[model samples]
Target: MTDEEVTEQVREDAEEQAEDAEAETETEDHLGPTSTKLVAEVATQDANLATELEGHLAQLEADREEARERADELESKLKRKQADFQNYKKRAKKRQEQMKDRATEDLVENLLDVRDNLVRAVEDDHENVESLKEGVEMTLKELDRVFEGENVEAIDPDPGTETDPQRHEVMMQVESDQPEGTVADVYQPGYEMGEKVLRAAQVTVSDGE
Candidate 1:
């Protein structure tokens, strides 16, 4: 071959060798180094995701714990309130009972003076039966004043009035000019406070005329 032809063939062979080296370098970057880098990047992302999930789980646990504490606090408050209400009811009931007892004691204390007056009237000496009766009447008047102050009244049903089972007790049945089931006579007067009869009037009931 001539010298110029040999030189041209050398130039072409050098270009082909350079292209093959570039292709080998590109293949190594794409299949070997780039694939390893991609796998490393994926591993890093997975680790970060796992860490984030752990953080979320911890936060959820904290929230649940806070909710539990709140529930316990409310329950405790409810129990305390219930206990307070029960105590208040008990105190009120005790106070009511005390008031009732005090009222009864006061009434009895007021009646003691009447008893004393009656005793004095009975024990004192008198000039005649009329004087003795007048002393007893005075004692009865004082007793009536006390009863009036205490809202107590005498149940002294008049003769010929209708007999009431709630306020009168029949002592005996007797024939009278009045209608049947009427009061013939009041043997003993009754005592009452408000609408409650302390003692029913003892009376003789009339039979049919």
Candidate 2:
């Protein structure tokens, strides 16, 4: 075939192809407005799904932040509890130590008055008999000063005061006109230091009843 004839045939084929494509497009358009609206609706639904997914992600992030804050609060409370327990233990230990020291001091205080009596007895003796007594008296006085410095008081019960079982011990009850339940005489003095009572006085109670 001639070149011009071949060229013309190719052109005709291309025109028919274009016409077929246009016909197919026209068929889709003829399906009506429902087809166009459906496609637009599908796009709108996709947008809505994207928005809902983003909202869920935001909610999950908020929940995670709240959980973290709660964990911090719990951790703070635990630390405070530990500190308070430590402080309480320290206070208890200090109180126990103070009680033990008080007990030891009471023992020392009770013996001070006895030592003083022995010193006075020997101090009134002659020089040859006084050397040993003088040495003992000095030692006893020094021991008493040590007790006084530690706030240990030697309690000597007076006869006029009403007898209390906590502070006085009755050795013998004798008939008298003093009172029915009062201490008649203090045989041995009691000792008290601060708020603690070391020993009760050995006393004779009046049997006025």
Candidate 3:
């Protein structure tokens, strides 16, 4: 071959190779922007999802904290109520004891005057047995007055009256001119206050003889 022909062929081949390289570069450039855009969108979606998840987690934490606070408030209220009830019970018991003591003190104070009169009667000298008996009767009348003021009644059943098991205690069965199962005589008078029997009447029952 000739030297000129060889040089021309080499130039043609170099030009075709440069044209192929340019086409490939153009194709890469066209695809590059779309691929980069898709990657960027995916990254943006992941970031939004992470932010939403963080928000949900924060709300859940807030709700849990509120519930804990409510429970603590309820527990505190229960403790306060229990303490109040215990204190009320103690106060009620103390008041009851004080009332009982006051009642006893008042009763003793009233009985003191009656005791003084009895002592004076015993210490005084009487001219005769009748005078002594009169003094004793007066003292007994005073005692009866005191008993009446206190609402204490005597449970002395009359002869031939019906025997009361609630207020009368049968001391002995006696042959008497009265109905059977009836009170013959009251041996000892009983005392009662209000609805309560302080002492039952000791009595004898008739045998209908």
Instruction: Identify the leading candidate in terms of TM-score.
Output: 3
Which scores greater on TM-score, model 1 or model 3?
A: 3
> lDDT tens string, model 1, 28-104?
87899778999999999999999999999999999999999999999999999999999999999999999999988
Ten-residue segment with the worst summed lDDT in candidate 2? Answer: 121-130
Query: Model 2 clash tally?
Result: 0
TM-score of each: 0.61, 0.54, 0.63
Count of backbone collisions within predicted model 1: 0
lDDT of 2 by residue, 37-138 (tens): 899999999999999999999999999999999999999999999999999999999999999988777766777666776667666556675776666777
| RMSD, one per candidate, in order | 8.6, 12.8, 8.1
- List, residue by residue over 79-143, the lDDT tens digit for candidate 3: 99999999999999999999999978877777787788788788998889898888888888878
Name the lDDT value of residue 179 in candidate 3.
96
Worst 10 residues of 3 by lDDT: 105-114
- Winner by lDDT between candidate 3 and candidate 2: 3
Alpha carbon lDDT at 130, candidate 3: 94
